[model samples]
Target chain A: MQEQWTTTIRPVSGWLNINLAELWRYRDLIALFVRRDFVASYKQTILGPLWFLIQPLFSTVVFTVIFGNIAKIPTDGLPPMLFYMAGIVSWNYFSSCMTNTANTFVANAGIFGKVYFPRLTVPVSVIIINLATFAIQFVLFLCILFYFTLKGAPVHISPWILLTPLLLLQMGILGLGIGIMVSSLTTKYRDLTFLVGFGTQLWMYATPIVYPMSQIPEKWRWLFALNPMAAVVETFRYAFLGVGVISTDVLAFSFGMTLLIFCIGVILFSRTEKTFMDTV
Target chain B: MSDTVIKIENLSKEYRLGTINHGTLYRDLQSWSARIRGKEDPNSKIASAGFKVQIGSFMALDDISFEVKQGDVLGIVGRNGAGKSTLLKIISRVTMPTRGEVKIKGRVASLLEVGTGFHPELTGRENIYLNGAILGMTKKEIGRKFDEIVDFAEIENFIDTPVKRYSSGMYVRLAFAVAANLEPEILIIDEVLAVGDAQFQKKCLGKMEQVSTKQGRTVLFVSHNMAMITSLCTSAVLLDSGKLRVRGNTSDVVLSYYTQYSGSPASFDFRSSNKFIGDDHAMLISGSVVDSEGNVANEFDIRNPVTITMRYRVTRPDHYRFIPNFHFYAPDGTCAFISGPQEVTTESGEFEAVCTIPGNYLNDGTYFVGLALSSMETGVKAHFYEQNALSFNVKDPIDNVPTRNGYAGPIPGMIRPKLDWKIRGVA
Candidate 1:
């Protein structure tokens, strides 16, 4: 009987135990959660899934008007509409994923208290659902990209376009990592819950969403590149519009930082999952 | 000597009293440096008073150890704060234990709350799949069982409707159906049966009975309803103040629970209870049981006349004619009787209303008395109502009232009033 025991629960022993196999066993549950999140968001709305296109489309329009036309910000030789659309498409996915993933523990504390599943399934599904949303909006961006290309706008498409999926994956991983870390901290110090929303807004400015990284002075450009999301957005534009500079050194730096943040997030999240019910 | 499916050893859970893990890191830093410097911590000196208050944390479950055998329906009986839910949480791995370990064999599914993962906006069919997946069932498994679930829930017509539009009864039925069909090796259920109507509750109990007896699975049930425990469980454990008080056959354990606590005279006091909910139309000060001699008692012989008394202060007398009432509840939570004052106008003052029951009227059982003050003019507008305001035991051990017709078990009824019988033989 002792040898055949299926599971053992105790005070979390020595180092962290992240049973990726256990998470794999709950893969169906992750899919269901993804479906639920996707469906429940637009269940009774008049626009339904069209609201997905509306968000980034409207944000691009605003950025094009305010930064491109009014403020006269340079688009690095690409059409302002296509340039802002590219940035918005990638940045929106990352930011929304971060916000939703950061709220995983606090929002689902009720479900967590009553049921036992791999806690990682929740954040994983958050990434997946946001990815689904990004895919839909990516289609909308492509339509605009085709229109700009056919109109003979000065956009140079590059071979790096094949790396678009890889860029999105990096952003998703980075968001999940930072989000879970914040979620763990916010469980006890709920002050972070309020600060996350405010900080994400501030974080957007620090990233090159409204302005290009080259627009920043060369002395301060490296500091801007340190924001992992800057590399992701820059790579996205370089791949699609083929105008923004692609630095392997900076891209490597961002990828390494994302990997580090993800490791830290997993460690904190695993530690927090052991006793989050008590604090949450 | 049976196969033990669950073994809990020296189990204890310490819960921080006021705040949970707040400023914990800062305090740990302070205390850790103090320990290194060979000095007492500055914040460890203040002693919090009362039972639930602690300077930092207190034990919710303390040194409780028990074993549950396979296929045994185990009843976990306790007061509200006796750590029953905490015990189940640890066993189900919903929460981690603080001090001990629980070894569980095979798959365990716990319905700590009904509809735990149910989303209101999702259709009933979708929610069934969602809740099933949350309980560790694969989608293919849920699909295979979907027909049986819809049939058992009796909601074939509403299966496609979002549960938000469902009546509370329908929601609970579908939720319970999904849970009952999980077919795990071990099942842990809290007091979720109180949600549905009587017929649904009966169906749920029957399903549970079939699950344990026919399927040969283990079950751990927690409920305040002693009658249900006595009828459903084969064995039981009683918890008192986070400690194991008794463990044995269900009848003995429940009887011991009744005697150990309910039989005490001082345990039925409602003077300190703030259960009275009202808008200041009236307020209940105390409620208790009194013998024919007019002294408050917790234990009573069946042949002795007893009176249920409630003392209250009427703040607004002219608002409506007050009907101060007493509700007698059997051990199974059924309302045995509801008696109140006559329809008469009364003034603002302190008043004590007593309803006396004659000797040989009530059957032998543990009973709870509730106090209610209502306005008859507005058609039963309750001004102050407190459920389970007081409790007592009705015993018939002396053969004073010959109720058993050569039967060994207790007689069933709310009342056992004796009537004169005549017999004539035409030989």
Candidate 2:
């Protein structure tokens, strides 16, 4: 009885008590969840982690044939394989994080109903796991970049390549923010779950994944730059191939959007985590 | 606040009867606009008591307040659906309370169900780490107690094997072992002891005792087993229909619950009942206990005979024999004996089975009878089973006779038959 607890439980009034320190204290749990998610998904498959590379590799070939060769999509003078692979890898990471994080509530309701942990740990682990997957695919992209360099294709490595990690970080935060917000909303309105997958697919075409940002007419280019992912993909292309749009305006707009989405996503997720069990 | 590990004040929870949020977005939007326009929602009307309510809510836990002192083991006893689980859920933060507050000292770990987050593909060692992390233990804490946990579970031989490959008993032991080793300041345990063997239960009780006494941790234990509650808990609370019925010393609270439970009825009405579990090939119409002359009796003379009459209507009776049975339970909740009809017959019409319990065979105490109807075949399939259908008291009054040299306290054991004995004087 000498040392008293500094903890109390009361009905939540409105916004969540977003305790960053509590989330920090649960860092090990987030790490284990990340490990578990990665290990369990590919445990019995013959291609274990090879699926990570094979997924984007196979998709890039299909995109090259359909969109590059037949559709006559301009790749800004970069090799079609290089162009498509970049889009595929970056888009795959964002979509997977979004889709998985969106299902975090319905998927883990069983465990959450029986135990108490920082609910934010679940979504944080999803982001980290998807980031690791992106790293693996990035290695594959480097190998392909090496082959093209030896063959002397006009693939200029710009100094802007130093900003690739920043681009990926922006995409990660944006996807995570939307995913958590959707996960919370879908608890009360289950129709949102059915729409999230289809919405993510349509969103890929809206970004510059299939076509370069230069292909858009000058008058409509401002409208296209509003998509935060478009900025990330275009900058990623500009950083590596030195042929796509890169400006202070696009980067500043993307950062602003990512911050807003991430904040709202966390607030919604933390609030829903308290009473989602009652509805779910 | 420092002396009390858990302080609950006016805690309550209300649950909607059916689908959450009115089951559609249209109704939700309606309510939202109503709030925006500063008007009462059209759907927020309370139903009168006499009418059939369409969509309504009930309070599972209603304004209950209590506290648990540091290092005190408090037992909560109640019948099923008495808001016991709801109370624990609110305290553990699995769900939030609808109103009021709870303040606690230090970390709290609740084991509502054992092995809650165990993945089947993970090995026992991996699962221990996973479960420990879920319960708020750091990786280093689990690693330090790894060997101690393995030894306590007695599953070192299968530690490396996947948990799915372990037998259910082994799985339970491993899960319980991890939970018992958690060194939280306050621990909450539900009815997880009913799964393991008796020996394992005893071990868990011993470990819990150590956790509270030696380590000075506060514990809140919920159990239906009064014997266990009386032995392991320092104090107890009795809940009845979402209210705190009584709270005091463990033995005193248990006695209050026992007396309240046995004071109900000598017969159960088969009508107006929905808590029945069976295929319903046949249904129990009525059941009661009576003397040989057919008078309803709640108090039986130990020297006489008592008959249990059960009336059931059979719908499908062409296949096998209908066996009606009675399971006698002593006051401490142990099955005393099971008696049923021996001769077999096939009958389809409504029938009554009267089985006589010969007196002078049972001890002087309160006894409860449970009814069961099964098909008397090679593989006995029970059609229906009902618990606590009828309860009665048995008393033995000596008339100008001396027994055990005027010993007047009470006799022990399930039966107190007067067996013949021969004694000789020794020089």
Candidate 3:
């Protein structure tokens, strides 16, 4: 009788063959990877998971002192502390996801060289871990937001708050796209490793994180539209604090650019993973 | 006959020689643009200056094709850089082959290295699940075998401790236990048994044997240990210089592998050879088998003791406690026994270690002896291991012997030791 082979390995695979079923089958591994990252990062530390909350809080205080107090950046008539906290919390999720996922290939090269799992699982787990951190920081943001509203500060919860999940999805996909693209390039050219950190720091300025989009001259405001993260941060602030410039055209453009980059990133990532072990 | 489970066709993997990078991004971009413009690579000129012939790609595996059937314990034997690992890597999907295809049926869990994704800070129990998942086991599957895995590793008390805190032996045991519990339809193992203690190695071998026989799983095992490949494998293939040299029954392939490489000579004189075998600690001079009369010989009587002697020079004496050992192997490559001195020597200079095998101990067959110098001061550190260093034959005379009692038929076993027997007829 002729036997049926379940898997056939060939020299070349289709460029867009992402193997979603195989990724689903290995979902448990992705969960374990996330848990390992969460547990290992805080293993020897005294505070443990509290560091997740402490990190964003510390960064907010620094931003409040340096950018708000020192530079005298306007918070669009909102309290400087609440304004900077919202922007820091929103920007932290995207930046952390991008920076962490960018090191996926180099950091996990040890395990990747020996086993055959979906290489995408590693970056996906990175995003999930960052999402969990974002969840904690988001809770902290809400507690402070509740205090400001109870004191009857100038804050409004807009109907656009319903777009929070969509905004998060866009940030995740955008980070994942840029992250995997850089990771794939670094496998062959290590020069990219040095550039990722510097590039992300510059990118935060390009997005309207510390200053509102209104601060940019109207003609140069179009330049901000080119950055996919600009829309995510502005929309997040508009939904919670009720004071940031956003338009439907900009949101649609951001979503389109995110999809485009994500497609390119997944294609490049899938192709590189098959043969990266040889070069890595 | 069982159906074929794995079919590899003309599989080949090519790798570029020398450094993978072109030193700088400027040169890389120059080469990339040159290629796009249909011009000769400017960087190739610089590379060809020093590396002329070595600048080209090298073939790690060359047109290798083989088939593995269900329940067949196939052994892949070859020298280093002979494409054994390349073949396994292709089959395991860890890397893509440059040419050809591999069609495999059912799940294939390859233990290329144990504890591949194990976290150092994770407890033993958590690492078990993590490692199991890395090897393609689901969390549910790992949970089901959790107790059995801890039991197999024999570290139940340390299950809650982080793996980094466990002893090296304990770490290896736990790692191997998780891999051994994997129930893949096809298992590929690559010399992972070379770790752990001797008793654990035996247990792992037994477990692998049961995996192939009782579970009816196809297994592909690669190891430099001839005895392991000979006993554990039902069929074996010999690869030389990235090419298939021989494929047949285990003993025949192993015999050809030895003859093709080491030549199975009667004696070795490393003193005259320019190639060195030992480290700065000690070096082997020569090894030979001798008769009772003290003359060098390769043939011995079954009833007479045959002495195997090793001569070596120890450069550093008091620094290490050198333990010299010899491994005796039957013609089929199954290790007959390993003998070493009970006491170690700390004195330096020339030393001759002789071990005598009494008559009637070895069965009538050809035997090969492997020599090694090791130190147990810290851990088991082998200075050098030269396999098939010397070979000899034991012959039994047809004349009636008291133990034989007029029967001339051949006796079966690794040895033929004479034991006291009492004949009391109860009937």
Candidate 4:
């Protein structure tokens, strides 16, 4: 029924031309992994997915107590609770993605060594699952947003809400970029694993999540927004509370930095996927 | 013109053994020294070996090159640490080569180990998609073949159960089904069939045959099982300590492997000091099986029957009830036969325990023999023999068996002793 068939092959010139068809081939796997990440994280847990809401909610209360009252950090004229919630939600999302993907090789070495699949799917699914959790947390922000709106509180859901999707995109890409960069590097240098936890902690302060960009003196304000995550958090507050600083310059610079990091990260990741097993 | 689906020019890999990496604290000092002196750092051995040697660093593979046409199942036979897995990893794109290049066409899938992409907490169905995707199979491809995979794995009910709950057998069955169903343009497997029950292993071989022979997918299989290689692969290559030992017909390459491991009898350094086996009654000080050439030949051919001479020292034969047990194992770790000296004499003595694997009885492959002097009457083993005792290889006498089957890996229920066959009626 079949005649003999054979084909010739050549070394792929370079990895620049990543085949989209191959990725499309694994679309269901991406979806399944995302679903598994989300479902499996809460499986049989007493709190279940409610933990998603609880995280930002609890973090907001803690920040309101420690930073809002204890440290006397200003929330840029908005209610301390809402101001901290926005940052917590977004920050946690990226942190989760980073944490999930950073261990890609160490966690799945057994599988990666055994079978061949586009290695990116594992990290990409982390972004998807964390994004879903962020959406759940976003609903909590809305409940607070509505309460403040009804209380005749001074607030505005700026038309800048249109750009919230951009924030999500930024979070996804930046998380993936940094996560992959660290994962590819950590395959050999495991010191990064220990550093990541504390690093993310210090990184949150650098992002202005508990304080406002305005709290910095005018001369020092430039340094505040230079932190890519700082600009993102500031802009998100500007959109929801209409009270934090927002600038095209800050967003554009952050975007550029994010794009650069992602490019470098993906390049390193692709190169490492070939030989990660040996080192990891 | 396009028959060669795979082509290699020069391939090599090096691994550093006994290497200790310099601590990161010394990084600045090393770099500073290199920059100031315009010379390499003194401790640059490991790093230089990594970048400089490429494949030649320690040379796991030294300039190996070969081609496999579509539908050609290529077997890579090598000893442990011989770089067979490294070659497969590079070709599969799971790992890059230290030197040379591999050009792969078509989608590739690999099964270097069972449950490669499985998440312990994920159910079998979820893992099917995850593992399939990891193997580069599209969702539609996985969906189209989902039922077939489950059916073949015989884990339909368990498909919804978390894979962590699955037994090792179920895990292997499902893993193989997902991998085999990928139907890649190129399938690279590395000793995954070494596990699993006999029936499942047979199914796996049958599936591999169907994938390569029927589906026309090119297969690159790495294994220590020469019987499987000889039977399934159309061509073969042997690697010996990072170099191509032989490359040609499957039969020739397998023979080359066997012959190299089949040590020469002329160089017997008698009193060569074989392993010790004893139970306080009798202890084996030294012994060796000399071939027909009157030299030490631990390994023999399928049709060759030889004598086993042993020298033992008996210490106080009274109340020291023990027997010398000799076991014969097929190459795939299957025991062909075993015999004990006390099967006849319940007495202990400085005796020579000799057992022969009757001629034409064991199907060709490697075999291991172990001598255990144990208290047979008391049923308490005073001493145990392990991975070392006695070992040998049996080569296939190709003249008799024209065609062989690929189902020759770790068969369950030991004693692969070949038995006489007769058909009373054709069912």
Candidate 5:
């Protein structure tokens, strides 16, 4: 009699076989991992989750002092604190999600070596945890926005503010995409590990996190738009302070790039998850 | 016939040795460029000067194939580097095999290491949820069994404390408790019971026994403890150096495992060998198993006497008396008995010691002989001790004289000695 099997293990799976149903089955694991990350990071610290707010607040101050006063960089005629806060809040979310997910394979090698679960759950959980942190920082940004609007500091809240969720989703997908891709390579070539931190730092400077896109010449602004993060940061500023440029074509292009990178990342990640234990 | 729950077919796993694929971008680029140029890899050991590199790849599992029926506890026994863990990893989906396939019919929960993904910073209750989720249990499932798990681990008072503060024993107990509560259809355990105390191990064994026998869950176990394998597993497979060596009933496979590692050759000829097993005083010449008729043989009848003969050369003849003894071991590595004569040997150039085991005394199974020589004049000084130097098998025919009495089934014990018995109708 022919027998029916629930699981068949083979050498390699199809390239596009992402196993979405399995990922859905392990959604609880993802939630648990997110909780572990949140609780474990602040176990003995005095500040605990408050650090989420303090980090961006301190960075916004530094940027306001250095770029707003000393260097005299333009923020499209908006308040330096509000402008830097907007950019830092959004940029922090994307960068943290990317770096954390980039270390997924290496950080959890101990657990991964011992058991079997949907490997995608780790990176996905990282995005969720960073999203939680981003939510806290976003509230901080909203309080500063409310104060500036009350003070009548030339702020305009546009209808584009409704696109904030879409913006966060795009950043998450982009971060997960680039993160797992690098993680897959770092398994065999450990040199990529050192590059991730340095590369992300440089990547942040390339985006319009400090200076407004108006500071760049019109000819060179397209080059900045090539960075998917630039559109995210620029669109975020335009939605909140009514400063910086926003174009439907650039937004569409950036979203397309995010999806494309996400597909590639998933492909590389699935391929690496199978036999990475050997090389790792 | 029972349903086949797991079917493994010719699975093999190969791992790259030394540095995997150059380990760095520079070396990897060098190799890649050389490959494109039709030249040997520049980063390869062959291209380097004055360096000897081991083989590029090692096969951890080589063409192993087996099947497990429903509710069958299959024990996998082998020494270290015997492909047992590799096979388990492949089946657990923790690693991919280089070739072949494995089809499993139901949910498999593998305890390759207990408490995997358990964060020390998390409290016991929190870690239970985390570790259970990692082992493929949902949140609601863990919550339903949370009380039972805590009770089984016996850490009711410390359930709220972080596991990092718990003692090692308590930690293992808690970890095992969570795993024991897992209700997967197929359980793959790899030496996880080697931890914990004796009482905990017994509890774990009882739980496993209940899971397989009462609940009808299939189990695949890997362990070095032969006694546990014999008691817990109905059948077993033996692996040696990445190859399947033996597969059969647990008793027979365990016997093969012992004989395989014991290196028993049925006879030893030390006369022509330069590396002698002795000091300057005495050297062993030869040893063999012989039947009652005095002809050299490794098989003996249950009703006939078996003799073990050892020849040795005494270079320094003196008043120091030498004693030669033979230790007979049963199949399970337990010493059945020790036989030696009280007579002393002095002023001897060459000597032969013969110890005869009477008929109908030994059981029908393979037995190993360990030869030794020692002098007791000045002190207990061993001249030579060769463990498992020779082995032989004793056959028990169904029509055996008066011992059987028409019973053909196996009799359980280390020795099956026939004794005189008288029965009368007193009732």
Candidate 6:
């Protein structure tokens, strides 16, 4: 367990312990924060949860037109719409998790400042809630691929799809890490809000979202590979579309970065949660 | 039986009043300048020489030591900024101590504020579990006590509604229910009950009593209500300026606190002593309410001037910097009214702050007067008297008459002071 955090006293927050027992006692609260994330955003909206499916569908169409036709980028010989949709489904999950997790401290400071809980439960639940929505969008993407394959489009579903769970974890860990880091900093300097929105878009470009990894320059390929999301999306294309162009080395790099960022993010977040109220 | 379930020994907390952005050019400059001047840096306690008391670092809690026995309700009372909440926050694990240690044998739950850990979009039912889990309750425990919690909160019907749609009462009920259901070994409440209505307050009191006496749980309740502390707490701790005054039997501590209230003559003196004490351009002297015949009046007659007389020191002409101010606080601690000179008390000599209460203005009750004399130009206090604060009670002219608009029933606010009145009409 590596010292198992004998004491977690950050300079900002005093002595905020992981306190698993207290966290276990308040397990119901984790479920509540999850429910809040799931329902609160969609409340009074016209489409409600249906909006989850529409996001990837709309993006898939727009990307198919622009990147497939106008830009004429190779979708690794697969239909550009299906190719981008798969990546979008995965990207949507990470992006939402990142955004929601980043807002954790600012959004829930009222609760956090007044009560004690395993602060980890908040970002953890946010990861879970958005995963559920992303899960729905993923299903829709799969149904589309099935329909396109029936119409005689080249479609390949590999057993690497089984590796989806690991890829998902990699994405969650990375998102959680980055989200927690930004969330902690956002308390002191809220300037991150706009940067995250714009940076996420730029980050997608670096990760080969609308483009394939093969299009990246070989020497600079390592650069994109470092962005964990690029590895997830590349592995995803390899799993469903049989785009085996990705190197195993790139994924190993992604995994290493994921764990590293997640560890650093957790430490920073736990430290920030203690005194965020004083500054926030 | 252990005499103390919680032992807090020599707890000290030091806080830096200024920012510490170290490793910066400005910081190096400041530290270097401090080294040359032999003064401490404004941001840190360290003198350039090292660890000296700087003007910036303040010890919020200095060697605070106390012990709470099982089943004892201890009240920590203090004025604002007196380190009361900070101590409670430290004990509750919501904050940490800078120095010293506290040992607790059992679980501790704190209600420093209400609606904590509540999700606005979540339903009451969902939030109950969510808040319970956040408070360190297991799911099974929350499930088991779910029904009782709903019943206690009296929000069962709206349990499925999002708390955002709830009225404040419903919101507080759900929040308080979750907090109340936390069966920690020790409960810490920090003036949070001020959110509840009188009925809910009584209910919370009953719950706290049950938790302490019936369940043998130790409780530390921080409040300003001497009456509640006197009645509900078994022991009390009085905190003044971040230091302990007395901690012993509740009645004795409360009696000592109330002694500061029994004297009303100071109210008159504070009001009338302005002739010599305040800026002489406007000084108050020998001022007291008097009967029609100019005799010192023990109490105000409804028709009396409530006369306030003052002697002033007129050092020269056109010295209009003197202004008399009177601030009143009701028995319930709500600021009632602040009145002052409508016209300049020029031509210094002595001046007084006085306002005659029109008949029927006040509801019968005890009230306090906080007097201050300030410079009219800068509005800074030339002289303020809080130590000599005065307390007075209005006697019902007709003890049985029992009626005044906006004065009946138990209401909490400023201006509960009573006055004599009559309603007349042409028949």
Judging by TM-score against the true structure, name the best candidate.
5
What's the CA error at residue B236 for candidate 4, in Å? 3.3
Which scores greater on lDDT, model 1 or model 6?
Answer: 1
lDDT of 3 by residue, A53-135 (tens): 88878888888899889999888988877888888888889988888888778888887877789999999999999899999
**Which candidate wins on lDDT?**
5
TM-score of each: 0.79, 0.79, 0.82, 0.78, 0.90, 0.73
Q: Which stretches of candidate 6 lie over 4 Å from their true place?
A: A1-26, B1-3, B20-55, B112-114, B255-427
- Candidate 3 displacement at residue A58 in angstroms: 1.2
- Model 4 lDDT, residue A99, Cα: 77
Model 6, residue A120: C-alpha shift (Å): 0.8
Candidate 5 displacement at residue B136 in angstroms: 1.2
Q: Which digits, one per residue and each the tens of the lDDT, describe model 5 over residues B312-389?
A: 988885677889999988755688888889898877688899999989888777788999998888788888999888
Docking class of 2: acceptable
lDDT of 3 at A194: 82
TM-score of 5: 0.90
Off by over 4 Å in 4: A1-25, A70-72, B16-56, B225-235, B249-252, B262-329, B333-427
lDDT tens digits, residue span B111-154, model 4? 74666667788899988887777777767888999999999999
For model 2, how does the per-residue alpha-carbon lDDT over B1-427 read when each residue is reduced to its tens digit? 3578888889888888875675456788888898899976655544234344577788888888998998999999988877898888877888999988888888888764755788777889988888888888999999999999999999999998878888888888888888889788988899788888889888988999999999999889999887678678999999887888898988557756765765435666556675444464777877888887898877887777778888887887758788888899865689989998877557787788898877666766567788888886668988887777787777667542233345665466777666777999998
TM-score of the B chain in each candidate versus the native B chain: 0.65, 0.63, 0.67, 0.68, 0.81, 0.61
- Measured with C-alpha atoms, the lDDT of residue A202 in candidate 6 is 87
- Worst lDDT 10-window in candidate 4 chain A: A3-12
What lDDT does each candidate get? 0.83, 0.83, 0.86, 0.74, 0.88, 0.71
Model 1, span A81-113: residue lDDT tens: 898999888988998889999988889899888
Cα-lDDT of candidate 6: 0.71
Mind giving the per-residue lDDT tens digits that candidate 4 earns over A101-197? Answer: 8888888887777665778878987888888888899999999988978887679878888899998899789989999888887777677888888
Tens digit of per-residue lDDT, candidate 6, span B198-298: 89888988998999999999889988876577557989887666667778987556544543434444224434333345443333443343434555543
